[model samples]
Target: MNFNQFKEKYQKFEVEEFPNKVTYSPLVSVLVQTYNHENYIRECLDSILYQKTDFDFEILLGEDYSTDTTREICKDYAEKNPENIRLFLHHPDNKIIINGVSTGNFNAFYNFYKAQGKYIAFCEGDDRWRDPFKLQKHINSFKTNFRLVMNYHSYITVDHNSNLFQTYQMKLQPIGNISGTQLLEGKFHPLLSTTCFKKVFNEIPLEMTQVMNVDTFLISLLGNFGDAIYLKNIFPSAYRIHKGGMWSLKEKKQKYLSKILTFTKLEEFYLSQGNKRLSQFYRDKKANTFKMAAVFYFLNLNFFQFIQNVWNYIKTKFFNLKFL
Candidate 1:
């Protein structure tokens, strides 16, 4: 996608006045993007709606067309909570839901531009916050520390059934400053739902749309604005792992393939930003995916794929060629 064209098209992604009549600035904007998450979307929305905060916050439910009842559910929530929920639906009668449409740019494009708050919090349909005070606490931290423009906390890992499997324990006190690299490779980078950052943005960076998993660069981009903090005092969010989720792949080779795609995009992204040093870091990271993919393919006796990945790895690692 031409980012220049994207900028021109959506630079003025007009924040139309809410039909429910909202004038006062909200304290936070909760972004929830979903597709066929009928089982979990309610819990996710409830978790945010139940949050105890003195200030008002709006939920931007970017309802990507879902074949199931996801859009209906979002429509219901928006109607019931007209003052709180804003439904951005891709279809009128779920045609887009059945057939599907290009969601890469618009799903996140609207989420970023349509926000009307000082802070932004993310909660996908499958993720939920453990603490009702999550927003209040993060807002307090931001208010207290002028330097901290970004804040993220820990989260627990849960199965699809909401069964807790492991805890991401971060025992240290709140950190005052964190770097972009540290945020990417740190012990607790945080799930999207676990972060509450100030809504300070100039333009939508090209990287957000170019990659599938924008997790690595999102915090880094936010970190560019100001130092970030990782909180350990509060309750962590619950990140559910299941078959439907994008990140969870049953096969080892598939996992490596996904990682390879993300890391390669990251390398290209870093290169686009003119950070050759970090670009090289992602380049090295991409090698592991290639190596792992090669091993998996060879063991599975997929000779062609194995040889292909091996050649890919050699070119990337030794030749230092930019994939983009």
Candidate 2:
């Protein structure tokens, strides 16, 4: 649907009625962090604004000095809808190069800290929900259990062009508990945008170390504190796939391969963070990662030039898998 259709459908959503109480659930703070998603930001913000939940909610839109008209569009929305929209413009005091690094974890941490809600939720600029009751579904789940993270599956990979693939439940653990080791073993949640958390976000310590892939580290910390519930009903948010996405397995094969190396290095440094069995599992997977990297690297390498390095590494380390 077009932007007008989306907005009209959103405005048509039925609002749920609520009973008066002395105290109420913490306002649901939805953080809509955008960098340069001028194409789909409206759909994202509209989805949140159109939620049929009875609980009060606010949006913290952290627009990171987008060069495109993303800032203008967001500002326009905030102006007419002043009560629910909180716009944070990321204007640097000292001029700096505007790389894709503007929407770092610090941006999320800072906005989340400023949120005056009891519960927190997130939606990316390039994604939107299909169901108007998405927030209400998660909020109702919290009433039954005050867990750290309340998650639901999403039908990702659909976009303006086509759907390359569909992910039903992107999270590694769907039925039971998930461990940090499972995350390292190539098992992980699809995107941080798939889940929402309690307003207990401030308790998380944000520092220099949390500059990248901070959501993984943050999820681990949250898992330590409480359980993460997963809803299984079939509604899913649309995740637009393009060059702008942080991690696209199809678009960034080389980058993804390098991440395997990073994961292995992290596993070694934080070895004590998980059990020995899980560490060993990742160690085995690390071997496969290296082998795949070698295969891809060798395919593009000069004949017999990098062959020596590849052969020596495989012979010296992965002797057992050599027969393959």
Candidate 3:
């Protein structure tokens, strides 16, 4: 559904809007989802606010009832920069639970629904954009190619102590586009924090709401619309690796389980979409992940879990069984 329809259906939650001073509509909406990110929220907001873009962009900050001072900080930023920031305070009860794990899906969905831009960019509260012209560069690429539905750049990883860990540069030469088929075949996967895509939420699948890794599903879904561009030369954004970070700090088993669930649902989703090849791709990925999980369990001396995962892998790979 469109933004208006989405808002009409889930308008029960309250939102605090800090109106922009500019009369022109925003060309890009930067979505920032945060929870207990008090330490990094300031830098995140500042990085976006510092962007040197000619076109107007609005920051849609979704603060998910942070237990720390994150909410206060977000409110302060919204009030001070009314022209750029629109903070949405979320309640704890509104969080979406997947497999008994609470997620920021509700917060993210609300921000997306309220976004008033042709293109939507994403950067979590813990990550910060390093390039001053990041948005301008991506917008330029989109404007030059009408078929491009998504664009992403390289990024650097920083450790919890704020030291540089690694740099992930795109290997594509001369900065070219990759088709949706390539994306589905695992030729390229973009970092969510470095991605900017066209706003087309009219056909968001029901499986998207059921999965925990919404970002991965979203990138895959965007590929269905058009090709994606890779920026090879832009200054890399910073992806923080902190102890409290969502994906960074997860245990290996937990990460494996999440991936398995995501792949299972994606396989079913593609099958329902009438893409048997893509469905099988995810099915194979799910089996591989299950095998890896079994190995991990064996290495950890968890015989029971190891046997369970091995059985699951056998069923998935040999019998074409589904987990969901």
Segments of candidate 2 deviating more than 4 angstroms: 1-26, 92-103, 146-148, 161-186, 199-211, 243-254, 257-288, 302-324
Query: What is the clash count for each candidate, in the order shown?
Result: 0, 0, 0
* Candidate 3 accuracy as lDDT: 0.81
Q: Mark the regions of model 3 whose C-alpha exceeds 4 Å error after superposition.
A: 1-24, 167-177, 243-250
Report the C-alpha lDDT of model 2 over 146-177, residue by residue, as the tens digit. Answer: 54354545556665553546444343435444
Of the two candidates 1 and 3, the one with more favorable lDDT, higher being better, is 3
TM-scores of all models?
Answer: 0.80, 0.67, 0.88
- Give all candidates' CA lDDT scores: 0.71, 0.59, 0.81
Model 3 TM-score?
Answer: 0.88
Clashing pairs in 1: none
| Worst ten in a row by lDDT for model 1 | 92-101
State the lDDT of candidate 3 residue by residue for 131-236, as single tens digits: 9999999999988899988888877778656678643332332245679776666556677888889996644566776778887788788877888988876798
RMSD of each candidate relative to the true structure? 5.0, 10.9, 3.4
Candidate with the greatest TM-score versus the true structure = 3
